[model samples]
Target: MWWKTARTRLDLGQRGMIMGILNTTPDSFSDGGSHAGVEAAVAHARQMIADGAAIIDIGGESTRPGAGEVAVAEEIARTAPVIAALRAEWAGAISIDTMKASVAAAALEAGADIVNDVSGLTADPDMERVCVESGCGVAVMHMQGDPRTMQVAPDYEDVVAEVRRFFEERLLSLVAAGIDAEAICFDPGIGFGKTVEHNLALLRALANLNVGGRPLLLGVSRKSFIGRVLGSTDLADRSWPTVAITAWAREAGAMIHRVHEVRPNTQALRMTEAILQGGNSAFSG
Candidate 1:
């Protein structure tokens, strides 16, 4: 099914769309404090929209491994203002990158368009209810544990099968709770609970996750797996690698890419789509 956001209609079987990342936290793994303030975050969100971002994902708290949790009040404080400002200023969709149902509901009330729950709606019982009540879009991602220790010797005997099963169960739960399947998207939670090898395997086998026609949202921007492959620890220096992974995800049937760099990856997806669709002349130009 195709999910309609404010600016993009994601055809589940077609080429991928771009969801630009805008973190309001002070310690996001990448590009964190750079946009911590409301003004800075708003400015960056505008720039991303101008750069061809279809969706701007705004996160208040850092979900980096080993990062401490933020209070619900603080998370709401950090994200609502930016979400409000962006909704007023930007014409595209706004995805609240949060797990807390209170924060998600507040952001939605403040004009955000989607809820990107990294815990796959398992973190908070009220999460599904918020989505159902708001009728907003949701990206339910699979993370084995909390950010504090998700990477501590994470194990999966059959990663792809396990992830697919998890998505199936969660999708069933959401549907049973009255959430429309068309309003849902899924992310495999790259780097959230997987080792480098596990991450690679998931990426390679991403096409196997065609969950009854729901759109797939693949977010592998500047992840540690890229560092492991390229022998680089600096996240800022991994733009090219991120672009490569975005293209790979597109080829693997991902319907959206949550990314840090919008322009280059946008260009890459356009080219990749053109080529994949038999050199369609409209996209070629």
Candidate 2:
């Protein structure tokens, strides 16, 4: 798959990019309200960049299961300032994590490079138009349903196949709407409205998703699935599992990783890439 460059084309071969999550909500499932304020969020973004994050994903609303929706004005208020501050402070890519077109457009204007829409640009009717007009990178993700009721009892005939189909259809829609294919990326939406088995299946079959040759993003950082597998509900105790998932994703050809813990994930991906390139495979093993 190929990604667009400002002046040239870029290849994602065996390279893995890290996208640091900056939740600006006061009630996110994990680490909410910690970075809700603009100063705290900017500081965290700077730290993530220092720890080797290729992109900073700033989310205004909490999408955790059963979470309430934030007003559009409030969402804009929560995310725009952080995006603007990070754009001035950090040199790496900044992504606005919202499904609202107005919020995305405002963020791009405030200096965001990408739109990380968790709803796959289907939540808001004008999302596609905003993305197309801004010419920014777009990460289209697959979610079975809205966050409020998604995890109640999510089911799929075939998890991987359904995700692949979702990506294809979303890509086609975006392309038809005048967005360049290179500006697109596919995300499987790891914990959003999915069971542990479904999440595992999607991760195992991640490379099968063909979104018109766009990059693939995998986000499974300290999620509930790790807790479910390890028999722990504590988010803080899932760090090791998060690192393991990062390594697994690296070996599976994931172009980008959305992670909570940036440094460890970065180190794991770097070492995994070295091993895959035929360098010190024994040590990695």
Candidate 3:
């Protein structure tokens, strides 16, 4: 499958491509303030790219549960410069993670290729127009509610079905609004509003999502749900678990993985790809 972005098309079949997450925010739940400046952010992006990430996803605002929103101008200030610097040296895909149209527009102007709207473009009415005008790839995600209250007693009759319905609606609406169907990818929003069970249910049902051939993007990197499931609070301990999930997701037919530590996850996906592609040639050696 191909994901068409603002400047180019990406081959999704290339070994479960990793979209490295570069959070340029001081309040993100994980890795906050680590790459808050342009230089630091650029350095990290370079490291991730060299580590085998096919795409770099930069986000300015903290979207952690109960996280407050950042202003459009402030968000752009945090992300646009970093995006510009990366674009200068990198020709690979760059994703701007923001919910506001103004922030997305500025990042696209500064050379971002995809808009990773955590709100799924439902928070900002102008977002649809901006995406249509820019022709950038979009990672439309599912969330039960806004970030501030998403996790407050989050409920789903059937988390997998509800998410699939959300994707179905978004695919039709976005295509009807002029986005090329190939330019859209569906993210189940793993930790957005899910309990441990809900998250697990979606992961197990990855191949069952009925999105009409669109790519499925999974971002479980360093998320709190992993900690909750593994009974570990240290963010450092979640790497292997995240990597394990990466391999599992890939085998389950996910095409894109959004991750914080790109190297290990990259290795996991690459190895998983190799094993899964083994033909029916019986082992003779």
Which candidate achieves the best TM-score against the true structure? Answer: 3
lDDT by residue for model 1 over 1-285, one digit each (tens)?
588543355564555678999998888887778998789999998888778788889998898899999999999999999999888876678899999999999998999888999999989988988988888888999998889999998999999999999989988989899888888889999999999988999999898987867888999988888888889888776899899888788888886999998988888888788888876513221
TM-score winner, 2 or 3:
3
What TM-score goes with each of the models?
0.95, 0.94, 0.96
The lDDT of model 1 is 0.86
Q: Write the per-residue lDDT of candidate 2 for residues 1-285, one digit (tens) a residue.
A: 666522234467657788999999999888989997889899998888888888889999988889998998999999999988877766678888998899998888888888899899999999988988878888899998999999999999999999999988888888999888898899999989899999999888877875577788888887888898988878788998888888888787787999998988888988888888976422221
lDDT at 267, model 1: 80
How would you order the candidates by TM-score, starting with the best?
Answer: 3, 1, 2
Q: Compared with the true structure, what per-residue lDDT tens digits does model 3 show for residues 92-120?
A: 99999998999999999999999998878
In model 3, which regions exceed 4 Å deviation? 279-285
Candidate 3 RMSD computed on C-alpha atoms after optimal superposition onto the true structure: 3.2
Pairs that clash in candidate 2:
none
Ranking by lDDT: 3, 1, 2
Each prediction's whole-model lDDT (CA) = 0.86, 0.85, 0.90
Candidate 2, backbone clash total: 0
Model 1: CA > 4 A from native: 5-13, 280-285
Look at candidate 2 and tell me the lDDT of residue 167: 89
